[model samples]
Target: MTQTLALVGAAGGAGTTRLAVEIGATLTRTGRDVAVVDAAYETQGLADYVDTIEADVTELVTDGAPLDSVVQPAALETPGQLSLCPARAPFERLARAKTAGAAETLEKQIAAIALSHDVVIVDTPPVATNQAVAAVDMADRIVAVTPDSERGADALARLSGRVRDVGESIDAVVANFADGTPQVADADTRVPATETTAPSQCPSCLDDETAFAPAVAAAVEAALDTTVELDFETSGRLDGLLR
Candidate 1:
């Protein structure tokens, strides 16, 4: 069966896009076809991961662009394909894409994408806009992505209410940018604060030695209910020393 999960941001810069991309990479390495669909129109941060974008998710949901055409596959050595359907649009189109009608179309568009892909991971903003609500509504599972801080936790608390308003609940929580085990309430895993690397070399979850690899793996297991091959032995400061 196909699985659809939304990684919703607890705050604006909660690293939701990064987490979604990393999750996609990890799933692809397991030989499962994965599509990281972007529903965060305003930020359009997912576009930063892909090399090029001839068309985007906005065009797909708003202008009726074909799914296969907008999907840009990443250059990964994994057995399964890792593709991104990101949104890169101006203010005008973005406004239209967030409309009630467009939000409904967005749900259908995501369902259509799920037909071909084994796993469809929606990169969503906080459940504020109509489109973001649609993303959550269409999702089979939902995970809140937040940074390892009090503000992130507070934002997460707010986000929980918003998600409940949309008739959904959070399946897991991932605390990003942590040196050790983060204390955020309900944080399933802690991803270290990794420095900026080339976009192509990113989703570093594929590398077992990376500090955040084990955390990413744990998130995958906890959120998606799957087993990860990577070991969670090296965590925190020692991870930096080994690498």
Candidate 2:
């Protein structure tokens, strides 16, 4: 069975894109057929991880093209392994499509992509929007990416409530930019915690080794085993939360 995971944030700038890239890359390295789709119409940063094709889910609703044609392979160091489908256009285009049923059409487009891959990692926009809600509603597992700060935790709490309203649950919470400091302990939430360190001074925000690669691998292993191991150097600090 194909497993689908949506990485969502309480609000923007919560590192959902980074987490999705790292996790997807890791899965690719482990010999899995991984497909990463950027569902967020506002930001397609996840496309930077690989050779990306600009696509709008709404196009599937109107054009009737098969989803496989719309997917673009990521241009990461690991080639021929990871695939990416980027959201280059706006969701407003989909909302405006004069299809018989817009929402159902959009859902079918997403389903087509999910059916083709062994693992589908979606980087969703904030939970406050209708598009994000649609992605989460269709996801089998949702990972809420938040920071280890009071405001970030509060945002997760609010998002958690919203997810519950739709009868969905957050499978985990990833703490981004978690320097190995006391601040890491601030995010006290129930979901399993995956802490990532701040990558060196680079344009893209993530550590080199532990950034996207390790996290993606860990998430994949965890999903298969029904438990994500949080023992890597960057993730080790979060062991307490896992226990």
Best by TM-score: 1
Q: How many clashes does the backbone of model 1 have?
A: 0
> What's each prediction's TM-score?
0.92, 0.73
Clashing pairs in 1: none
Q: Count the backbone clashes (under 3 Å) in each candidate.
A: 0, 7
lDDT of 1 by residue, 1-243 (tens): 899998899999898898899888988878899999999999998899977789998888888887788889898999899989989999999988899999999899888889989999999999999988998898888999888888888988999999988788999888877765455867876777777556666878877766667667777887787786645567455442221
Superposed by TM-score, candidate 2 places the C-alpha of residue 70 at a distance from the truth, in angstroms, of 1.8
Q: RMSD for all candidates, in order, please.
A: 2.8, 5.2
Q: lDDT score, residue 233, model 1?
A: 62
Error of model 2, residue 199, in angstroms: 13
lDDT of 2 by residue, 1-243 (tens): 878887887777776766665666666544556677766766656545444354544565556656766677655554225667665545666445433365456556667776667778777877665667777888888877777567677887888898998788877666554544423343422223344334222122123343443444444544333444333556564443332
Question: What is the model-wide C-alpha lDDT for candidate 1?
Answer: 0.84
Residue 104 in model 1: shift from native, Å? 0.8
Please state the error at residue 130 of candidate 1 in Å: 0.9
- Indicate the residue-level lDDT of 76 in model 1: 90
